[model samples]
Target: MEDGKLTVRAVERALDIMLCFTGATELTLTEIASRVDLHKSTVHRLLASLEGKGFIMRDAATDKYRLGYRLWELSANLSKEGDPGIILLPEMERLRDQLGETISLYVQDGLLRVRIQAVQSNQAIRRVAPVGARMPLYVGASSKVLVAFAEPALHEKLLASADWPTGLDQQAFLQQLSDTKLAGFATSVEEREPGAAAVSAPVLDRGGRLVAALAVSGPANRLTLEVMQEQAPLIMEAARRMGTMLR
Candidate 1:
């Protein structure tokens, strides 16, 4: 039992060292030691083990360590493994067929949202949101849906931050979020992109936790306020279907 505990502590320390690389490209031994609160020799030992496993690499000239390609490979593989795109593709296709608008699935990543799947509209002038596109968590219908359904702690943090979308203050945004929650969905008109409008619904898991957002977007001219209001039910139904399948 003691040996197992020691192994677990070692793994945790190693992970702490790796997590120090967040928002940083490279770190020297002293920087890592300071961040992880470990002795230089202990940090060196951990670095050696990580280097051997290709989780980090040491530059020959600078002696600084950076994340290795193996981490990227593992992250990519993990993203692929847990990707909701494959599971949601059929629903997305069905919604696309029904609405004839661009369909996208967005998942939260920290304070940002990423588009994991997108099906472009068949029309010539339709909006296009490509897979892998990232946007702040405070703008657009999809982002608002995520924020509306997110934890209260996250809401407080985001509200306190200086990242509110243009022409919106904290009070107005909070009211908007409240309205979104009450309505069970969100809508935006030229919020993120000019002449683009979208409606989004939250996809929740079995435990009633927000998982992702399903959005349908198109040009504002075609997807006017009335049109979006009319299609709200369809968008929400599709979101419910996706949530059911995911659960």
Candidate 2:
């Protein structure tokens, strides 16, 4: 192979090693080398270079390498294609102003739900879950709403097989999913994190399939059953409008 071809092959292998950190928390150099089909010494050299650049780091006690905080920092700044999130920020702002509650847009990635956009509430007490935050499918209102309305195969698989961080029982989770669909939205009081209550409704695409979730969150005391019920229509309307633009 030419010099350029060898360089490209080496770069591809390095990237493969880096991609392994997406779902996994950490891996030893030997483990990474074996997965990538590279020599351990070569993997170590590449990892050292990536670590020096703040893309990877090793645990002091375990000596296992994982993605660095810098990787998280960088991923948060990435924009979606055509940047609908940026364009929709004003709409989120309008909803926040109207309701005085924090609003967010979440999308599914495999078994995880990622917050892609958010608008902070103007109330004295505000929920502070940041954009780029992610949680398992069975945790938050937004996550469950998405899962409930997703394809039945995916819903069953996630409810049956995927390990939820929240440790919720499968049967109970399925029940909640059923209720969320009937209500046309989801509401949870501290299901995923403490001291917060969230309401979420599905965001459909042009095809009217559930593609994302639109949510509002606040203190449990402030966001009572009546309040979330009132906000449901507003959230559903906003999701419908946004879906038109996304399509």
**Candidate achieving the largest lDDT:** 1
TM-score winner = 2
Q: Write the per-residue lDDT of candidate 1 for residues 60-116, one digit (tens) a residue.
A: 999999999898888676654445788889999999999999999999998889888
C-alpha RMSD values across all candidates: 7.2, 6.5
Candidate 1 CA-lDDT value: 0.89
Q: Give the lDDT of residue 81 in candidate 1.
A: 47
Candidate 1, 38: how far from true, in Å? 30
Weakest ten-residue segment in model 1 by summed lDDT: 75-84
- Give the whole-model CA lDDT for all candidates, comma-separated: 0.89, 0.84
Candidate 1 segments exceeding 4 Å error: 1-82, 165-167
lDDT of 2 by residue, 1-247 (tens): 5999989977887799887765567999888988888899899989988899888999989999998878778868887665656766887888899889999988888888888889988777899757777787868899888898888887867856647445567788789989988978999888877888999988777888776888999999999878998889998888778778765
